[model samples]
Structure formats: structure tokens, C-alpha cells
Target: MTSKKSPVGGHIPVAGGMATKGLKYAAEIGAEAVQVFVSNPRGWAQAAGKPAEDAAMRESGVPTFVHAPYLVNFGSPTPETLERSVASVRHSLQRGAAIGALGVVVHTGSAVTQPFDDAMRQVREHVLPLLDELPNDAPDILLEPMAGQGAMLCATVDQLGPFFEHLENHPKLGVCLDTCHAFCAGHDLAAPDGVQKTLDLLVETVGPGRLKLVHANDSKDPCGSFKDRHENIGAGQIGEKPFAELFRHPEVAGVPFIIETPGRSADPHRKDVETLKRLRDNA
Candidate 1:
């Protein structure tokens, strides 16, 4: 979030190079803020990035975010999984700062085989230190609540309270609210005034300035479906009106909207970015 209106963008690809290929894609889609994975989304690898990539992104002057691998689950009951999760998170934080990411997004994972309390204890033990040791220049760690599926530790914005408590509300800790996940978690964003209510609750839950980013996506399933499928804006169950309302929300005044919508090339991402820009400008 900043002093100006939110910038809309997409999760651009970093195939040949981050700044070269990724920013090219970002330019193609007219992104104002961007999101990218530092490693394989479904794997445990955490690769180092090039300094040129970091310098290029920083010089580009666009707000950016890093989405951690999907396998990061500190709430896991298994020893190896928890270890890898912590390492992966640490690497992400390092790489994010290197690449000038404004925030690093990691999912609020599940309890798996353990009890909820035990899993949260594990989270506190493994994650609190990382938050505590974050460099002054490093990006904030954004905890992304998942869809209300399985033993997810945090889904609804209300659930974020416990996480904040465990981490003692670290200043660098933030939240990335995914539209499709919220819809599936039963926020009812498709209903009239639903977007307002959800955002109001988010501010209430996390307090002001903690909502750093928004994953601007639509859901393929109905509200309360608990599915994570993402669709294009206005082309799914959440519809487009809610996004217009999102633009009008006072709490997310300077936040960036990054579309994680369906797309193979830049066409769909460009459309989603333009659509959000229209809604935001019109709002």
C-alpha cells in the first residue's frame, strides 16, 4: 500500500531471466505491481537469483512480491516437512530482498496429522524467529490464508488473529488476501456489499497497514465451495462488481492488485489488468 491509488498487475513469468523475460511480460500486460515465484511452486527448492535481475527490478521502480513455494507448510506434523518449510521460507526472504520484493507471500498451512494447537506451536517455533531476524531492508512476510479446506490454520480473515498473536504482531508480518480463496472460505464476495464487509473485517482482523497485497482472481466454484480454482475477473462466481467495490475500500487505499488468473500468454493477464484498472479508475 502507498499514498496513491493501487497499481494492478499479474504474476508474470521469469523464464529466460527475471527482469528480461519477466518484466517484458509485465510490460506486455501493463503491470504496475508484479508477483513471481523464486522457486518451483510445488517443490522444496530455493534457488539463488542473479544480481543483475535484482538491480534491474529495483531500477524499474515497480512494486514487486515473491510467492513462496506451495510446499511450505510450517504447520506440518512431520519433522522433514517442517525443516524444509523453514529453510524454504528463509531462502525466500533472502531472495525476495535480493530481487527487491516488497513482500513475500507464504500460505498459512494446515495442521496435517497433529492437533490444531500443536501445529500452531510448531508454526510459532519455526516461523517466529524468521520474522524476528528479518533485515531492515528485507520484504515483509505476508501470510496468505487458504481456502477452508482440510485442517487449514487460517482461511477467513478472523483466523489471522491467532497468527498475529503467535508472532506477537511483528511489524514486518503482513497478509495477502486471495479473492478466490476468500470466496471459497465463505466470505460471500459475490453478494451485494460483500466486498465491503470482507475488507472491513480484514482491517478489523489485521489492523491497518498489514494488508500489503491482493491476489485479484475469481473462483470457478460457488461461495463456500472450499476449492482453490482461479478464473478470470468477472468471468466466474465472484463476478466483477465486487472488484469495483474493492477499489472503493478505504483500507486498501495504496495496496497493489496482482492477478493470478487463468492465462497461457499475456492476452488474458493484460485483459485482467486493464479490467482492474478500469474498475479502480471508475470507482
Candidate 2:
């Protein structure tokens, strides 16, 4: 197995291509890790992965992760949506395994108009079965809590425990804490010692080992705004202070951070990576 190096990186766009060129783009931007989509993030179609490309990725030594489709919402009221969500997760895991990815990230979707209890039950009934079916060699399934927008299932970090309880706390399950989402969901990551307090809560709730990934984004909206917009590092409501605190936190030392900030091209991403590295070194 390729060992993890530095934990800081960003989500490289698949503008060049998937797998092959994606890996090259990540390296060019100084990413020590990367997150990519195995298929259309907005669609349900499953694309066949290339074995040669997968092998190259494994040998490239960059820690990789696959983000499942955006349309996947196990808490959806529609039966078709729930069914497709499960299938998309399954396919994403398979692709992750093929590419030797460390983990597969999926949003802990919204409950919509459904009663919250009913939504949890839907996750238990529909989502747990899929989790049980994951291959032993498959990458860990990392659940990313969403912004508390319209009945979001795992809006707050505390809610992660209940979600895990529904999944029976499967060994392969993990958490991907998105800083921007957490702040928007009212985690108060901007306060004094805020990042440490947030990490403490995560460690207490999910155990330190399961805190596998961090989405290092700054929020476009203010705290508790329920907006999911992301801005470049140090450029949003979440300034550089919180990020420096995040890097200094002992629990997050080796955890991979993938920035989901916005930019027209690679230049912005490169700068973000450099900024994060500087923070870590200085911290």
C-alpha cells in the first residue's frame, strides 16, 4: 500500500479527464492528496474504470478519494431517488477500490418534507443494506455532514452519532468534516479555540480514528446561514485564523484535507494549497 505523506490537498476538477489526467493535475497543483468523481456527479450513470489508469494512480503515491454523486440522497421521500442513491454509492465504492482510493465521500443528505424520524428509518432500512454489501477490500465510506439546509440529516456534528447508530457503526464507515458546512450549521468555528473545540466534539462523538478526512473550505455565507457556498481559503467568512487553529489541532495532524473552494482555474487552487502548507508549517 502507498503510505500517506502530507494530509493537505484540494479537490482537483476533472476538466482534463478522469483518473489519468486528474492525477497529473493534482500533482501539478502541489496536492499531496486529491478528491475526484468517478462518474457524473449529477447523474446516475456508472462509467467503467480503466485498470491501467488505476494502477498508475496507485503508484503515483498521492492519496486519492472518490466523491459519490451529488444526486444521492438516501433520505429522499421518493422511492426512485432512494434506490438510485444506494446504487450510486455502491458503484462509487467499486470504483474507489479499483483505483486504490483511501475513502469514498458521500453527503448525509436532507430529509426534505419527510418527518425526521421517518427519514432516519429510511436511512436505516435503505442505506444500511448498501453499507453491509460493501466489499471487504472496498475503501472506507466517509459521510460528509451537509449545511443545515431544509432538514439536512447530519447538519450538526452531534447528529453524526445518530446517523452512525442507524448504520450500526460499521467498521468501514467514517466521517469527513467540512469546515464551511460545520460553520454554516452553527458549529462556531470562528471563535477563540473554536477549531480545537470542534475537533474535540468530533473525537468525542465519532472516535478519533473515524475522523478520516477534512473538507478545508471557507464559507461564502455567515455562521448559521444555511448556505452551502464555498470560498477560497482565507477569503470567506472563515478567515485564516481558524484554519491555522485547524492545522495546529493535534487530532487533525495526519488527516487528509481537500479544499472545495471556488476558482476559475488551477491558479487559485495552487495558491490555496501553498497557503495551507504555510499554515501547517507555521502552526
lDDT of 2 by residue, 1-283 (tens): 1122347887866645555678777877789899988889999999887777777777877888999999999889999999899889999988888888889999999889998889889989987777788777779999999989888888888889888888899888999999999999998898996787888988888876788899999998999998899999999998888987887777776888898889877889989998988887777
Q: After superposition, how far is residue 189 of candidate 2 from its true place, in Å?
A: 1.0
Put down candidate 1 lDDT per residue, 84-188, tens digits, no spaces. 999998998988888888999999999987899998999899999999999778999999999999999999999999999998999999999999999999999
Candidate 2 to truth, TM: 0.95
Q: List residue ranges in candidate 1 displaced over 4 A.
A: 1-3
TM values, all candidates: 0.98, 0.95
TM-score, cand. 1: 0.98
**lDDT of each prediction vs. the true structure?**
0.92, 0.85
RMSD of 1: 1.4
Go through the candidates in order and give the clash count of each. 1, 0
